[model samples]
Target: MSLIILASLVFLLMPIFLLLYIRSYNRHKKNHFLEKLNMQQKFESEMLQTRVEVQDQTMQSIATELHDNVGQLLSLTTLTLNSVNLNDAEKAKKKIDNSLSLVNKSIKELRELAKLLHGEQLVENGIGHAIHQEINWLNKTGAYELKINNQLLDVQVTSPDKDLIILRLLQEIINNIIKHAQAKHIQIDSYLEKNALHLRVRDNGVGFDPNEIKVKKSGMGLNSIYKRIEMINGKLALNSAPGEGTSISIEIPYP
Candidate 1:
């Protein structure tokens, strides 16, 4: 009777043991596949970023050539044309004046292109200084009031990946506030907390439902924000509602 009882117990346990074993095996397989997928995706993202950087460098080179070579040639050609001696002296003076005006205009355009192409000011002075300068410039331009809290002002952020990520994140936030927020006031605060960099960008503007907006066809922008944060193993929070304000908080881990 005891032998028969033991046999029944083993029979009852066999299916559960098999099920647990299969579950573990499948979980391991899923995890392995997911790791491979993540690796492939990271490779693709890096490649795309490299391509974009190359394209940007090429564009800057073209812009420089246009301003330096083409613009200088135009100015020199105008001067040479003006130096020409003509029998109609009065008409020649008028034409020379016109050419001089054209040259001056070209110089102005070249100066602007130079500003855009050469001086980023972001790399030289560091990201914090650059952000403050940009915020100051923005505030000076219109009815926009910007408040920047720089807790990490004296602390140098030398991590290239982190620096680029923060800059991109801030740029997107500022662009969103400027384009969509329609707010009179903006606030940005940053500091190091709990072994991570914390940032908040807030504005007194109308807000939308994150759920509704994130699912739309034009969801690329929102997805970009989330994906970038995810790629860096960071955390992001959004606070907003209709007729209320919007605030975005981001936290990037150290090491």
Candidate 2:
């Protein structure tokens, strides 16, 4: 009787143990599925945020160019027109000619701005052209001497989101140089190698200690660059020293 009772309990407990094991497995699978879903959602949210920030920066660039470049050109044209002596044919012709030239320049600038306004389409086009367009706009300022070697111009590879992030990253770096570097020369090189995209930017600027920036957590822009690069599984190398120039190199996997 004792042996029969013991056997019966073992049989009953086996089914219970199996039920518990199945329940635990199902719970684990459900948890894993939820975690993956959450991670995907987070990625999408970050991507959207990055897009908004890029758009905001583009708009700011547009506003600045219009006010500083195109606006000045138009204003000068207006003043020349206002001073024209219509009664004197020769003088009037000269002033009118100058005004026409200015107007034409302004028209060209407006056309460039129109292209900038389509900044989002940049990804659709390709990173190389978009970068060239940006460099052209920066050159218009005539503030810095730029040496550029962009080898990716003819290469056809697409990574839309990464391209936008890369553009924003370059813009941030340029803005930092413009605002604080007090530099006179900028060098940019971009190319593809070993299935990786590389961008290198160097500036003869009043450099700072990268270690200090990291320790103090003071380089907000730098932090953003690192964060975005990490998001894209990319890497950044920064070389800088006080009284020496700064150089930044970014490496990212290709599409």
Candidate 3:
């Protein structure tokens, strides 16, 4: 009788244990689904923010180019035309020629500005070409000695969202250098290896302590870069010192 009772108990406990396990498994599945949904929402939010920042940066570049470049050229052309001595045919012809040259230069600048206006489209072309376009614009500034080895120009694979974020990250880094680095040389290298995309930027700028920046939550847009890299599951290694300059390396999974 005791043996029969023990077997009966064992059979009853088995169902309870199975029921508990099913309940626990279902709970875990629900939690995992919710966690995944939250992550998807966060990634979408970051992408939206990245899009806005890219647009804003493009607009700012356009405004600056218009004011500092096209506007100045047009103004000089106006002045030249105004000073033309129509009474002296030779002098009048010379001033008119100069004015025409200025107008042509202004047109060229406007065309370049138009290219910048299509910032989103540039990224759509290919991240490699987008990067080259950015470097060209920076080169035009003649602010730094640039050594570029961008091997992505012919790369066929792309991730549109990642491309935009990467471009903005580069822009932010260059902006930080322009505003605070006070360094004269900048080097950019980008390539693909071992199923990953790598980007490295080194500047001979007045560097700072990364630890101090983290503690103080100070400038250089380091925090922003970190957050974006995390969003894309990328890794960044930043090295810097007071007089040693700054170098940043980033690696991300590719398409």
TM-score for each of the candidates: 0.56, 0.90, 0.94
Top lDDT prediction, candidate number: 3
Lowest summed lDDT window (length 10), candidate 1: 115-124
Q: Tell me model 2's lDDT, rounded to 2 decimals.
A: 0.88
lDDT of 1 at 64: 58
Rank order (by lDDT, best first): 3, 2, 1
**Per-residue accuracy of model 3 over 1-255 as CA lDDT, tens digit each:** 999999999999999999999999999999999999999999899989988998898898888889988999999999999999889999999999999999999999999889988998999998998899889878878789999999999999989999999998999888988998889999999999998999999999899889887676547788899889888889988889999899999999985
Give the alpha carbon lDDT tens digit for every residue of 183-204 in model 1.
8888899887777888899989
RMSD of each: 7.8, 2.4, 1.7
On lDDT, the stronger of 2 and 3 is 3
The 0-to-1 C-alpha lDDT of every candidate, in the order given, reads 0.69, 0.88, 0.91
User: Model 1 — TM-score against the truth?
Assistant: 0.56
Which pairs of residues collide in candidate 3? none
lDDT of 1 at 212: 70
Better of 1 and 3 by TM-score: 3
Q: lDDT (0-100) at residue 184 of candidate 3? A: 93
